[model samples]
Target: MAVDLNEFKHPSWITAAGAITGYLLILIVLTVALFIVPWLVFLAL
Candidate 1:
């Protein structure tokens, strides 16, 4: 499956902002999980 960008329109500022916000949200969730999961496992032991 090849990605074709020939017909893709350039993203506006709003689209760019949305993508950035989404990325940040994902990073934050992963970071929180990474930090909290260790403690959770330790507590369960």
Candidate 2:
């Protein structure tokens, strides 16, 4: 299925906030998987 860009338009700040939140969420997940989890596992072993 394809997404429609022009449907249900929102304010610009709302769109910006959503994009930033998504970006930050991706960073946080990568950091945890690549760094934090490895550190914890190293300490455990």
Candidate 3:
């Protein structure tokens, strides 16, 4: 089977958007977890 690179092409903006959204999601989750764990530990004491 052969694949065509042209047929699998994505626009630059789409790639950039995907990367930016993924980065933001990871950042938000990390930020939430970072703060929440400390608070939970404090409460458990």
User: Which candidate wins on lDDT?
Assistant: 2
- Each prediction's total of clashing residue pairs, residues at least 3 apart in sequence or on different chains, is 0, 0, 0
For all candidates in order, the CA lDDT equals 0.84, 0.92, 0.87
Q: Tens digit of lDDT per residue, candidate 2, span 1-45? A: 999877647688679889999999999999999999999999999
Best by TM-score: 2
Candidate 1 lDDT over residue span 1-45, tens digit each:
999775455567669888999999999999879988888988999
lDDT of 3 by residue, 1-45 (tens): 888777546687678888999999999999879998889989999
Instruction: Report model 2's TM-score to 2 decimal places.
Output: 0.70
TM per prediction: 0.57, 0.70, 0.60
lDDT of 1: 0.84
Candidate 1 has which clashing residue pairs, if any?
none
- Look at candidate 3 and tell me the lDDT of residue 8: 44
The 10 consecutive residues of candidate 2 with the worst lDDT sum are: 5-14
Comparing 1 and 2 on lDDT, the stronger one: 2
**Model 3 CA deviation exceeding 4 Å by range:** 1-10
RMSD after CA superposition, every candidate: 6.1, 6.2, 4.5
Model 3: how large is the Cα RMSD against the reference? 4.5
Clashes of 1: 0
